[model samples]
Structures are given as structure tokens and as C-alpha cells.
Target chain A: MKNSPTKNQISSYIIQSQEEEIKRIALELHEGVGQTLYSLYSGLQFIEQTINSSNMKSYVNEMSQLLEKTIQEIRLLSVELHPPTLTTLGLVPAMKSYLRMFTSTYGILVDLDIEGQEPNLTETQKITLFRVCQEALGNVAKYADTHFIQLDFLFVDNNLTMTINDNGKGFTVENEMQRSSGLAAMKERMNLIGGQCLITSEIGKGTTIDVLLPL
Target chain B: MVMDNLYNQTYMKQACEQLQGTIECDFVGLAFQESKGPNIGWKYASGNSNDKYERITLRYGKGIAGRVLSTGRPMEIKYFPQNILGKALEYPIMLAEKLLYAYAVPILINGIPKGVLLVGFRSETSISDDEKKFVEKAAADIKKFLSLEKM
Candidate 1:
């Protein structure tokens, strides 16, 4: 099941469909509701100026604060659902931006490094790799009780690999692989891209997830 | 919007500090039910080793935290380490944190539980009744905090 073409094709089909759906929802949230909220915020700014009374202005200010949080939340949600940068800016930039956001939002520091030149991969492969990284980071946040996460994307010798490692309380990989859907999903995503995922962990040590794709 | 996040961070820091000091627990966390989803997960944690508390999206009534959310009352587990809490997956925070004794109370706003305040010990010990009361008191303070949000 690791490198089965049939599985890849099927997984690709299913993932493509899901991506389409998620893309649609993300666009709606970003372009549709996001624009509306942006406009609403503009209106509040107008109200803030027009309302001369200090108390009234204070009320407007609070409302504006709340709306701003909502807007940021929507934007974050949209990106999480479908990262526009992954499609437009390519993988390296996408991961950099994502890790920055992850650190800011979750207070988990991540160090990302890229080695060798970027390998040319299809849109499907790129998204698969990005998704795999996302899943790996998520697992680190959930199960790994560590302050630092490390990511490396290397392209060398006609092979592309991404390793996400964290210094957190690690679990037994075999036992967790069977029970954790997140770990399984990361593996499945790699398999769908005709790549292999290797997960290693030890109790009280840390966990490392590696994805290797043949270029 | 950034201000709201800052405020939350400050509040969480204060809450956790006070709660852990009073409850004598190694760690404390707060989780709110998502407005868009029927799930609750940790939003802030003090003395936290990781973000495991933030990663869970518990459905109401599904697990220990969920139970507290559903019942809108305080609950305490005297012993842990794979004890009953629905399933292993449902207790990710406990499994990851290796908490022994735990207590949680609902943060109610206008009589509806909107969030939960959890405090736990890393090593196992019999939880005293006074410790449970401390949790309840912390929960009440949190409830007041939520009420301020309504204002």
C-alpha cells in the first residue's frame, strides 16, 4: 500500500475533490464574508470619527476591536482551509508563511530550513507535501509537549524530502500510528503522492516525521 | 483585533497563575467552545509543557471535558493513567500531560456554560475537598470574566 499506483490514483481523486470543496469554502470565507467584514470595519471607522461623545466613541471602539478579531479569525480560517500562497507563491514561501503564522498563533517556535534548490513537482505533489507538513506540525502541537519544532526541506540526488522534528514528549510510533488518525493521514497523503513517510518517536525524547518523494 | 488577543493572553496568564497558586496544581488551562463549531479546546494554558491542550476538539458529552461542558458542573477524577474518561483519544491532554488527579469546572455566562477551567497535577495524589473548592472558586472568577465579555 506504500507505493501502489491504484491507491495513489484513488487517493488523488478523493483529495482533489476535497481540495475543490475546501477551496470553494475558503474563497467564500475570504472573498465574500471577508470583504463584507472589511467594509463593515470601514464603516465603523466612519462612526468612530462621527461620534463625538467620548462614551459613544468608546462603544464604537470596542465594537471595532471585536470586529477586528473576527476578521483576523476569518482570514486565518480561510488560509488554514486553503492556503492561497501554496498555489500562487509555491511551496517554500508557503511553508515559511505558515510557520510564521503557527508560531504567532500557537506560541510554538518552529525553525524551517531548505537545502539544495527546489525540485520541480506537480501541483498535486506540492500540495501533498504542504499538507503533510501541516499534519506533522499539528501532531507536534497536539502530542508533542515541546517549545521548539524543526522543519527541513531538502532536494538532493533526484529525491525531495521534508522532515518535521520536534523536541517534545514522544510516543511509541507503532501504537500511535494505529490509533492516531492524524499520523495515518500524513502517511496517506505521502502515499497518495507516491512518496514514503517515516515516523520515529521515543518516550520523553521527541518525534520526527519524514516524507520522501522521488523527483 | 490584536488587542483582543493581547487581552486574552494577559487574562489567561493571570488566571492560570492565580489558579495554580490557589489550587496547588502543576498546571492550569482554559478552553472555550468554538463559536462556529460544537467543540471546545484549550485556548490558554499555564505551566503547560505543550499545546496538547489546544489541539483537542471535544464534542459535548464525549469525554471528561465534554462531560463538564455538557453538565455545566464541576467534576473531579481522583486517579488517572488510563482510567475511565470515555477513550484514550478523548483524553489527549491527560495522556500527553501525564496528569494524575484532575478537576474541572464550567465557566458559565448567563447560566450557559461557555468554557471550562481545568487544573491538574502531574503526579498522582488524593485530591482533597479543599482543592476541589479552589477549582470551583477559580471557575466562579472565570465566570465573572466571561460576564465582563458580555458587557
Candidate 2:
């Protein structure tokens, strides 16, 4: 092949391109679809207050409730496509806010412990870590049997380390690779930044994901 | 109330159902002004056999809806006469739906026509003056239903 790139290079390029597209679509959803929905809701409120029939009022009330839920869904979708704070606030605050959403939606409790000081990280590195964390938490919510999760961070020897542990019915790594692309995507995100990801799991036990990032 | 996709669909379905009972027509449809286009097409229709009406776009003075929308007036054809239309090629929806007679009520907001509500019958029949009044009132009510946007 002429000017051939490695498979890893192609995959990293794909990820970076996808992130850029996500930002564009997220803004469109928030501004276009989201605004139209807001206008509809406001329209319903006017009808509800002006109407005198109890039966019609009830019908209006039901539709208004549905609209409110829809507006929230769009807002959530826009935020998930690209978190606005991820770039400006850096990794920790972004992850912290993300974890709040993640736990509230999944109804799981996460105990996060930070050690040492926050290390200097490239924007790419920070985003990679955030994606890795996102993937790990998604896996936990999907497969974990336990309600509790543990997240630990460390900085030592010019390396930044993070672990995500879940008390879930751990699947065989080989079997999981065949079943889902989640782990592969996580590994790809880590590999793009020269980070190391170690996923350890055993049947009837919990799963642990440890990531080491050279600072 | 913020309109979401699902909620919008549900609201339209409900409105169409209510229109059927009030207008007592075989078909009930709503068409809104296209945000970027000068033409309008049926956006929602219930009691429709297929989506033919929704697909036909209408320009001002082009179809029955076009005339009503432009004039901000309600119109009705009591009989489905072959020669009632000015031109055969002008009304694609009439041919598509095979509507014998129909009524169009201009959904006006601030005396400006923003949309049109169309109801039709399959066969030639008279739309009573009383029934016509009801359809006109429904158009006014729809405006009130949309007034919350200003708030």
C-alpha cells in the first residue's frame, strides 16, 4: 500500500474525527431541535391557563409533562455528545461532574479517592482518560451486580495512575472480547495516548481496570 | 411545556382525533408554514388512508389550501364537482385523496395565517352552516393553544 498507515494510527484518527463530529452535532441538537421543543412547551402553558374545561386542562397537563421530559432528554443527549466543561475545566472537574450524572442515572454509589497532586497532562491525554473512565463506568452499570464502585487516583514516579473497581459478575476477558466492543474501544482510547490499561476479572468475583499514564 | 419529538407526535395525534369528532369529517389534517420555505405541506394527518396529502406541497393561490392560507379566510366546497377547481393540474391532493368535498379553516394567530386545517369527505355532501361554524371555532382555539410561546 502506498503511504500506508498502521491499523492503530487509522483507529486513532477515526476516534479524533468522531469527537470533532460529535461536537458539531451536539451544538445543532441544542440550538435547533432543543429550541423548537422549548417553544412547543411554552405554547402548551398558554393553552392550559386560558382553558376553563377541567377535562381539557387535564389533557393539556399530560402533554406538558411529556414535553418537559422530552426537553430534558434532548439536553442530556447534547451534553453527552460533548461535555462543555471538559476542555475548559480540565479532567478532574469534568470527570467529577460526569460521575455525578453517571451515578444519579444508574443509581450506583461511587467512592472516589484522589492521591498526591494532579499531574500535568496533555489535553489529548486528559480526554483519553475521561473516555476510559466513561467506558468503565458504563460497563459497571450494565454488568455489575453490586451497587458500589471504587475509583482511586495516584501520581508517583512521573506516572499518573487510576483504578476503577466494580463488584460485578466478572466475565472472562476472552469471552467479553467476542461479545462486545466496549473493552476494545477503551483499550483503543488508552493506546492513543501511550497509556497502559490492565483489565483483570474472574468469574464470581469483581472486575478491576487499572490505567497507568506517563506524565 | 417544551415540545419533544414524542410529545409533538402525541399532541398532533390527539388534536387530529379531537378535530375528527368536532368537524365530523372523514379526514383531518394540519399544515404549518415551513420555516425556510415559502410553501406549506401537511405536517400531520390522522384518519388518512396513506401519507399522500402530507407529501403534496402547496404554494399560495396554487390549491384550495393555498387560496385559504393567502386570504386568511375559511373556504368550503359543498359538492365534489368535477369542474369546481380552476385547473385539474392545480390540485394534486384532491386527485390523490379523491375528496368529493372539503373545508379549509385558516389557523390564524394575530390575524396572520400561520397554518391551515383541512377536513374532507369521501363523497359529495353538504357541510352544514353549523358544522362550518364549529370548524372555524376550532381554528381559533388552536391559536390559543399556541399562545404560550410568547410567555
Candidate 3:
């Protein structure tokens, strides 16, 4: 007799499908709406130069400006939804690009320190790590009230470890773990990939998240 | 370009201070979309307890400033964290400034909303109609200044 899938397996499948859906939407937003808006902006510029009346030219200019803003917004949304670099250039580059955008958006600087050579990683492992980091950084931005963060990536023999530390107002780990679905999801994602996530915090000191994966 | 940005910053600071004085509010903040990017951030603030406002950046419809920019309208919250549509965390400005009441109006440039001017009160108080008008006037002045600077 065939065995039924476990709860963890079902949730893992759901998370995988969700990621695939997000990737598809991100691609559509980038290539479809984003490109169309760019062309619209160009067309407006062309019309602006040909128009003889100053009033008409000004109106065209404003339209172009609005279009430009929309294009930028769509571009950012697409990247935030699913960074193309993660698939193309691999984890480190993708993380760097994401950190840059995160700093620009939140004005919180993340100091990344890498140790040892990067080991070969499966696609699932790479994506899982990326998603976990993204979720962790988002929490830091929302609740940390911090201006600075430290992310350390360490690679040892057949093992990879990542540590994220924030020097901001912390909370009780037990209470927050129950209250935050994001934290739960992070742990679930790591567990699906045979990894462990540990979170520790103090009220006045800070919070630290450690993720360990064995290859 | 650098000089123009500096000029805008100085002007915005002065305008925020003027508005805070006239409106008798505890804080006044000006958030603007970057000229080269889509990020909207609080660039200037008056009566700010800390520099935390400068660290906040929102997308099109996330926070108070973002909502005002997207909707192109004025928004007023008399009792914050209560009767609000979403989570209190969504209003970063209110949380950062510890404000109980806030009024935000869009700064329209060429009929396009490109910025937000917000006034907040730490203590619970209803904003008078005259005070609302002052905020609107301040937003108009910022719109005018930005439009002229573009040329």
C-alpha cells in the first residue's frame, strides 16, 4: 500500500508552488508591464519634442515623468518579488544585490562577512537560504528599530552556517516565536531542507538568528 | 544637481519648521520620491525627537506618506492605533514620532502627486479647520517650489 504524505511534506509542496507562482508573476511584471511603460515614456518624450505649444510640451513632460516613476516602481517590485540574480549568478551575488537594495530602501546598513570558500549547493538549498535571509532581514527592519546589522556566512567541511545579528530593541524569544508567523515559516523552510534555525533574544540587548545546513 | 538638492533640503527644512510653528503641532515631516528612483523617504522633519525619520522608506501604498502619494488626497487620523484600517506598524512616521494624531496631504507637482507633507500631534487633539488649511497651504508651497526647481 502507498503511504500518505506527512503534514511537513504537504506544507513543503505548498511553499514550493508558492515560490514558483511568485517567480512567474515577477517575470511577467518585469517583461510585460515594465517594458510597456518604458516604451510609453519614450513615446511621450518623442511627442514632447515634436509639440510646438509650450503648454502641450509641459503636459507631455509630466506624463513622461509619471511614466518614468511607474517604470521604476515596477522594476523594484519585480526584483523584490523574485530576484533574477539568485537563479542566474548564484547565492552570494544575489545576496549582495538584495542587501544593497535593502539598505537603500530601509537605510539600515548590513555588514556581510564571509569566511572560507563557497561550497557547491543544490538549487533548493540556495533558494531556501536566500528566502530565509530575506525573511530575517525583513523582520529586522520592521521590529528591530536598528540602524545596523551584521550577517556572517561561514563555510566549513560539508557544512554551511549563517548568522544574523541586530543591535536593536529585542523581545522575548518564546513570545515572539508564537506571535510571528514569519519566524515559524522560516523554521519550516529550514526544516524542509534538513537545516536548523535558532533564534535567541533578550529584552534590552539584541536578537540573533543562526542557520546551519549540512551538505 | 548637487547644489539643487542642497537648496531643496534647506527649503524643505524651513518650510517644515514654518508649518510646525503655524499649525502648533509637535512634528512636521516632508517625504518625497527620489528624483532618480521610486523610493519615497522622509527627507525633512521639524521637532523630531530623533533622526529615525530619515531611515524610513516606503513603496507606493505601504505607510502614511505612501498612501497619500498613491491616493493623491489628504488623510487625517485623530486617534492612532485605534480605528485605523491596518496594523499600527504600517504607520512608521506615527510610531517613530510617537504621535497620537496626524494629518497628511499630497504635494502635487504639475497635477501629479509626488510628495507628502505631514503634521502630527503627540497629545490627543482634534485638528481645527484652520489648522488643516495651514497644512494644505504648506503642501502647495512645496509643490510650487519643486515645480519651479524642475525648470
DockQ per candidate, 2 decimals: 0.11, 0.01, 0.41
lDDT of 3 by residue, B1-151 (tens): 2113677779889999999998888999988876565567888899987676787776566567768887899999878878987766567777667788999999887677878899999899868988899899889988777778778
TM-score against native, each model: 0.67, 0.52, 0.86
The top-ranked prediction according to lDDT is 3
Cα lDDT tens digits, model 3, A89-194, are 8788878988877775666789999998777787778889999999998888667777789999999888899999998889998898889999998998999999
lDDT for model 1, please: 0.75
Name the regions of candidate 3 deviating beyond 4 angstroms: B1-11, B22-26, B33-40, B55-58, B77-101, B121-130, B144-151
Residue B107 alpha-carbon offset, candidate 1, angstroms = 11
Q: Which run of 10 residues does model 1 chain A get worst, by summed lDDT?
A: A99-108
Order of the predicted models by DockQ, top scorer first: 3, 1, 2
In candidate 3, position A135 carries an lDDT of 91
Chain A TM-score, each candidate: 0.90, 0.80, 0.92
Best by DockQ: 3
The lDDT per prediction is: 0.75, 0.73, 0.83
lDDT of 1 by residue, B4-81 (tens): 467766876798888888767787888885655333567778877666456555445644666787688887766774
Quote the lDDT for B79 in model 2: 59
What's the fnat for candidate 1, on a 0 to 1 scale? 0.02
Reference-based TM-score, model 1: 0.67
- Candidate 1, residue B132: the lDDT equals 79
Model 1 clash tally, residue pairs: 0
